[model samples]
Target: MTTAVAPPLLEDTQLGPKAGGFYRYQNIWTGLGFGIFLGFVAWLVSHATVQGSNWGTDMVVTCTMVAWVVGFNIGMGTFNAPIHWILGHDQTHEDELYAAGVGQGSSRYLKFCTDHKVVGTQYLVLVMVLFGVGGTLAMMIRTQLITPHSSFLDPQTYNAIVTIHGMVMIIATIIMVSGPFANFIMPIMIGAKDMAFPRLNAMSFWVVVSAVPCLLATFFLGGVNAGWTTYAPLSVQAPAAMDAFAMTIITFVVSVTVAGVNTIVTVVTMRAKGMTMGRLPIFTWGTVVGGALGLYAMPAFLAVMTMMITDRATGTSFFVPEVGGSQWLYENIFWIMGHPEVYVILLPPVAAVLEIASTFARKPVFGYKVAIAGFVAIAALSIMVWAHHMFTTGWAPNLAAPFMLTTELISIPTGIIFLCTIGTLWKGSIWTRLPMWFVYLFVWNFIIGGVTGIYLSDVPADQFFHGDMFVTAHFHYTLLGGAMIGATAAVCYWFPKVSGRMLNERVGKVAFWMIAIGIQVTYFGQFWEGFQGMARRIAYYNPHYETANQMSTAGAYLLMAGWLVFLYMMINGWRHGKIAPANPWHAKTLEWKVPTPVPLENFLVDPVVTSDPYTYGEGVPDGQEVPESAPAPEPELVPAGSAPGDQIDAGGAS
Candidate 1:
């Protein structure tokens, strides 16, 4: 197997001077920049609380804070400083460069780095930590739900646990799917060195991280019990915890906005020559569309969260029933962002699954153009379908007809993605590899998830299932099936690429089966329990619901076991598994073309484009095996007025 020659750094005369200036001022500016911004926000909040007449001031301060943060990162050279130092420039010191740890934790991580890979890993870690915390809350809720009318926990505590669980899970879903895989894999797939704006990438992650403490503070400060949605009069009536929740959500929206901008810029501008829109990988296309949705949807969420914060702290009656505040405004704004937010969390992972399936099946992604179109359709359709979630919440009946139509229309594009997956696997030499297994599972799970979604979207059917266990079951199917499964599959598929070691197949398979079965056991019961009239978030549910709840609890054990085993396998693999080849999966992607333990700047020389990634079967040159080595063919170099050093012909034809 041949190793890929790394790509050379592209010189940018226009950017070089600006980059140097920013690097020179980086250390001093980054610390003070964030500090000043935080101080300003604190002051504004304090002022608003005390004086009470300056409603416009809060909006102005928010805009200014966001702008300053974005500009400060750009001014400090967070993104390109590492690249500058690594490319043999001496404007920056070795110590400064080393402190940044190449591209892994650039000083940019303290600010913003435009490297999607770094942002992705940041999201992965962030989401995993939150997932653990969320799961703890879930355990508490489960413990309460285990027995009928038992006082193991008080009603208030139960409410807090349920609320926290829902909020954390929502945040986890948003951050998990797009952050790691999209950040890490998208550039690699499209053959770029880094995201279009590495600084913005870093900013996105830090924005998300900064929000976490605020979220946790909610629990300590009499947590909001209205669940993550924080609906209506109950939300306004909640304690100081509601303030914290609102602030946390606002922070999250900013993070999503930053991420959205970065993703859009990177996908639009950073693709390799010949990697046109039609040629872009399925996952990359998914991220592009998903990021767009996030960009458009997040601003509305930010507005609503700000309005909520005002309602809680400043007594501005956006949702206050008595003071010209319409509760329906909250519902309108929340679902506007909320529904598309679901697709934002989901589509990228679905895209990742498509890429995984194509890679392991040793085939071109079936209907590549069709898949891209599907993603675009899904993005557009996602916005119009938001009211479907609010059908029974007294939205206009006229609204329901349009929303119902749009919601159901989304299935058309969603089905296209499904068709692509099935076609990719049809009559193909499928490798029963760990990644592929997860891909197969994703398809099955997503199918069920999609079908279940139909029932929820139909207004008539949703009227019955609106606030019951059925809603929970539907979401679990959608999230676990579509998002979590796809994310896990991506982890398995790319773990070797990231860590340069092979995970244990046996343990991986064990984890996969347990998770698959466990999910079925856990959520399927919710459907039956919901059908029989069980409400969610009640500490003490009906005794008639006991059997299904017990079964779900039992399934949770299996689920936990599967995750534990998977974690152990990954940790052990990193420590002692066999060193991996550069292209372990024998896939056709630019990332696999690079050496293992990817270099500081990613490539040593710029790669010249040749062919599309998944050009399998007859598309590949006759009698030429898909090289289980590098994505690029060996280049014939024109001697630089001298013979090449120790050129060894590895007995292969060009």
Candidate 2:
């Protein structure tokens, strides 16, 4: 009788003594630490609530709370595991369970692990939930607008709902770029096992989860009446409900910072041996630049929010104009983070669409280097253009010219992204796959969005359009056209890879057309209404605006219906769709090379690259076909305890 061979050890040696078993303990300690810190802060806040003081003490307390939340995560081993490995923890796993092509969902996904894929799904599901909530609020707002002076909701309740809707959408925007797509796809595209700092990754997500309920609590907490900007003097004078808004913003800022740091470190250090900076996928590069902006830009927002909290609670004068503080300071700092924040949300999806188009067209990205350079240019210029939002507010006229020039100049780099998309599609074999179709639509929508942006960038035109429906139309096009479409395309393209099943193509196409048409009907009416002088954020308006409002309300229903269908298709696809083979798209990326369901530790042995990822058609050789050599055929999905890497030649057997 033959003796059974011993299974190879599968410990995460790179993580040192704090590897597998210790995560449980780490979680426990982290929870305890957070509870104690929050308890003390609550005590102080209660005292301030009772005292009714006008001293600047509230600012100090809010700052202390923000510091504690941010600092504890840094201290108690959240981001420590990745840092440990990066600094030289010398253990290695040789077991089949740890190999590439193995597929197992980690406990970390259920808990808070920093795996980009887990964070990506977390962001996707979280954003979807928020989107639903925001949409519901929008329906209520429209009900009020269904007729002039209708009072479908009281002004207070209406304002609260509208404020929450805006805040939810803002948070959603932040995650749309950084969370699902960046976290999930960046590591895969860069050919890394996971994010550079996984624990920090988990920490960032958990922070957001903790903050969200508190934000939603505002509905019951006396309700924030000011819009998402929380413009002070108004915010300061509003009910205690504003406290919840301030707290949520502070928590969100902390979460964004953690994510930003993780992204920057991961891209800088963890690329595959051959994946140089220049060779990085455009989407990954977009994440890098956006992450950099988030890290630096978010602090100003945190500072401003901290000041607002202090003014509200401690009776400070930071933004109370009657108390010698300047309200404009708040506006300046808010937009400082605000405008770049838009780019932060928009850039990744644009980049993702570019990558999807290139892959689907079976061509090299037309201008890979130029595309990356464009992202860089956008990031740098985004900071300068924040003042453009302030143009109608009466800053210097000379300042207006500079802001206008910088704002218009941004279109140049943005135009390059458009050119790259068109070039990739030039005479290419166009497969009308769901993802590709969305990419084509993205190009069309973004072109319209970009051009309309020019009309707003000019100071003279903006003077007439600021705060009008025209402004509303411009942003909806940018946000919905650019960000929403990109996100849908990514979900469609990656559904098979992520879920280990194919989506229903017929249903997906139906969903796409509905959304496309719905968007046009919803926003196209707003442009004419805006040009005719209808204002946003008002519950009552003149009858002259009635026709446009009626049409917009009708379009909103269509938009909601389209999203419902899309959601249905996604759910059905996951549960009932056909089992997918690896590399269903026949693409050359390393992520698609992995086994379906993807193993716990990523790859067993490290991957070695010998072929270019963009080669297609006649350039791809027999036996060396991109899909064949990239992902070896598996007779069946590997079960637990099997050697996933043993079935195929990862780097070709020596």
Compute the lDDT for candidate 1.
0.73
| Among all candidates shown, the one with the greatest TM-score | 2
Tell me how candidate 2 scores on lDDT.
Answer: 0.73
In model 2, residue pairs whose N, Cα or C atoms come closer than 3 Å (at least 3 residues apart or on different chains), thus clashing, are 13-91, 99-603, 99-604, 100-603, 100-604, 102-599, 103-598, 103-599, 114-198
lDDT of 2 at 570: 85
At residue 500, give the lDDT of candidate 2. 78
By lDDT, the best candidate is 1
Models 1 onward score TM values of 0.83, 0.85
